[model samples]
Target chain A: MNLLLQLFLSFFQIGLFSIGGGYAAMPLIQAQTVEIHKWLTPLEFADLVTIAEMTPGPIAINSATFVGMRVAGISGVLVATFGNVLPSVIIMLIFAKLYERYSEQTLMKHVLEGVRPTVVAAIFTAGLSLLNLAVGSISALDLFALAVFVAAFLFANSKKITLSPITLLLFGALGGIGWEALGF
Target chain B: MSGKPAIDLKFYLKLFWTTFTLSLFTFGGGFVIVSLMRKKMVDQYGWINDEEMMDFITIAQSSPGPIAVNASLMVGYHLAGIPGALISTLGTILPPMIILTFVSIGYQAVAENTWIKAAFHGMRAVVAAIVLQVTWALFKSLAEKKNILPLVLFAAAFVALFVFKVNIMVVMVAMILLSVVLSIHETKKENMS
Candidate 1:
């Protein structure tokens, strides 16, 4: 198969089966890019994960773009990203249509009623996992992280002080630099 | 509520710009994007109400692919049909596609920088905090409905994930079935009465 064709097919498969979102898609990405195609070394793959986490947009897009650029070039980037996003766009279009049509029906409402709470639970779990990553562990809690978490939480929940997400993220980056400067 | 506002060129541009900036700033993965979208789409633009946003999220999360892209598609379609969905999705993927292409050129520098690491550390904490706030808001909305079943399902879902470590897809499927069955039983009881 052509390299661009290969990239498309691999990412198309990745996007189709990546039902649980970005993090869940990581292993499949690693297997295809690292083990199967040898498009990226293991170390490069690890770095890709970090870069994906730090950069904007979803990890799947990041991974696809990175690997595609590595393998081909700008064309590779377009092909790979389109492959990854195509599955999602198609799937979501059908879902959006169905949801708009039936969302008002009682059965659909009850299904949403059940699913909504689980979504909340999933978000809560994601928060806890991120917290664990930030603090390292409860035994050796990072006080700086705890303080930042508390302050950001308060700011977010406050009525009088409204800050955009970007503003909050900038403040966080500054706090990190200050902590590093203080050598703590 | 009133019908969706007219889909003019300005509306299309706003849709593009909204998802564009949201995609550019969304770090720390899927849940982080959700928080930002809630703030921009629901709180700021008033494009969708809180309940509708929740429904969009539910569908997005449950569907395939990245939650951010999926959610953007739904929101776009809701506001302005297929063209809106395509435009919003284009905005959503462009940042990562462009940034990662450049980053792929010199990622070693980025991956090894201590200051960058420290900054991400701090950002991670804030990301967690933002998601926590969103979770609380969702919980509060569910509580406001004055129903115990959803509350019970919430707890059950938590325990299943936190304790038993069940896969999220499995838990989601189980909950949907349970909810549908309960809805049927309630309707039958109402009919009998």
Candidate 2:
């Protein structure tokens, strides 16, 4: 298979099957990029994961762009990103159309009602995992992280503060640097 | 819906710009972008209400792709049309593409930076916090409905995922089927009355 075509097909399959979101897609991405296709080495894949986490956008898009660039430069980036996004565009458009058409129906309303709670639960779980990853264990809790979490949560919920997500993220970065400077 | 906004170039640009900026700063993952999107689309712009946003999110999560991109497509389509969807999707992707291009070039330097790692460490906590806030908000909204099913489903789903480690796809399908059955039962009861 041609390299670009291979990249496109691999990512397109990833896009099609990545059902639960970015985190769920990680193993699949790893398998294709590192093990199966050998597009990236294991060390490079790990670095890509870190970069993906630290950077903006979802992990899928970030990895696709990074791996694509490594494989084939700018054109690779475009092809892979496009492949990853194509399924999303198609699936979402269909869903959007169906939702618009059937949203008023009682059955559809109930279905949404049922799904919304699960979505909440999923988000909660994602948050917990992230917290666990960041803070490590309860016994060895990072006080700095805990404090930032508390402060950020407070600021986010406070009506008077009007803090945006970007500001909060910046604050997090600054706090980290400040903590490190203070020898913590 | 009445008073629908015209699908004009200005509207498309606004949609593009909104997703672009959101994508640019969105750390963590799909959920983080969602919270910011709610703030921008629902709170700041008044483009969509909380209920609609929640629906968009549910659909985005259930769809096959990045939730952020899926969400952008849904929102853009909802507000404008196909063209809006295309533009917003473009906006959501461009930032990551641009950033990663640079990062790929400087992979060694970035991968080895302690300061960057420290910043990310701090940012992770904030990301978790932001997600917690969003979860709470969604939970509160479901609570306000005064319905037991959603509440129960929420608890059950949480347990299923966190405790038992069931696959998400399985949980989603089961919940959808259960919802459909429950709705049918309710409809029958109403008809009887």
lDDT of 1: 0.79
Clashing pairs in 1: none
The numbered model that scores best in DockQ is 2
Q: Which window of ten consecutive residues has the lowest lDDT sum in model 2 chain B?
A: B1-10
**Candidate 2 lDDT over residue span A1-184, tens digit each:** 8999989988887787566676656645765787678988654664465567568988888988988998998899999999999999887877776786643356756766676777677767766766676677899998888989989889988889977666887898888878877777
lDDT of each: 0.79, 0.79
User: Which residue pairs collide in model 2, if any?
Assistant: none
TM-score, every prediction: 0.62, 0.64
Q: Is the docking of candidate 1 incorrect, acceptable, medium or high quality?
A: acceptable
Give the native contact fraction of candidate 2. 0.80
Residue-by-residue lDDT tens digits, candidate 2, B71-148: 989888888888878898999999999999899988745755878667777777777777678778778998998879
DockQ, candidate no. 2: 0.46
Cα lDDT for residue B157, model 1?
A: 86
